[model samples]
Target: MNENEKIREEILNTVNGLSDEQLNANPEKGRWSIIQVLDHLYLMERAITKSIADKLKSDERVQAVDKPIELTVNRDVKVEAPSYVVPSDSFQTLDEVKDKLAESRSAFVQLVHNADENDLEQKSFPHPLFKDLSLKQWIPFVGFHEKRHLLQIEELKSKL
Candidate 1:
């Protein structure tokens, strides 16, 4: 979680000077804008947090092997964003997205801090590409996922 916080701070610093218009500008026809990327991160975090909470409260226990989830940061292999996590095209301010991000992160942190490590390791959830991932792995996976988009955000900023 410390590492995740560092990455999150880096992301915020990366966009510190930009205007809202720059954040919302699309780099190309098919690509997402910077704000959209941030929004996607927020949505993904919230969804993962909820899923973890659900699994923790359930009696189901499916042990899963740890995956190379760090591979998530590799941009060479393109994975489509799940529809639920896809960001809207509407313009959004950084503060708006940041608030959403904060709320999601707060919930995620609270859940993680309260959850038992053994419970997290015993439960599993399916990832589209990674198959069934343990809840234990899902925690850091969020950070890796954010790191992936941080690179994308940098690219989008360059184009803007």
Candidate 2:
């Protein structure tokens, strides 16, 4: 399996048996619940996949920087979610979150399969925190983003 697929599998495995209470309970007043984190991850994945697909179809291409991956993968720096990608209380159950994540991940995998290797490196999309990133970088960014939240989920679980 590819790195992206491995990461996706790991995330699904990590949250496989979480109850609704566990998923929705926030560890602290200002902190996000596991469900909220998953929702944000789904939103970000869907948005990033769409952005990369759009960029691939467009005639425009931008020079991608190498630093975006570094910045995104760095766990020490906490970056706030953009307004558009922020999670809401819309998800009432863990099943609902799982459905959305499955749909988004399927679309993401399809986009990756359909894209050319050259185009993956050439096409660029705007990231809220890191600015423009190539399709290649964006795929892995999804994984890293999930991994980051996995740590949060673990912390939340501990508090429960």
Positional deviation of residue 147's Cα in model 2 after best superposition, in angstroms? 1.0
**Model 2's lDDT to the true fold?**
0.80
lDDT of 1 by residue, 115-134 (tens): 99999989999999999999
Q: Write the per-residue lDDT of candidate 2 for residues 1-160, one digit (tens) a residue.
A: 1766776677777777888887888779988888898888889989988888888898887869755464555668888788988888654697888899999989988888889888888878777777787878888888877777777777787887
Against the reference, the lDDT scores of all candidates come to: 0.94, 0.80
- Candidate 1 residue pairs in clash (backbone atoms < 3 Å): none
Please report how far candidate 1 places residue 115 from its true position, in Å: 0.1
What residue pairs are clashing in model 2? Answer: none
TM-score of candidate 2 on Cα atoms, chains taken together: 0.90
Which candidate has the highest lDDT of all? Answer: 1
Residue 99 alpha-carbon offset, candidate 1, angstroms? 0.6
Give stretches of model 2 more than 4 Å off: 68-71
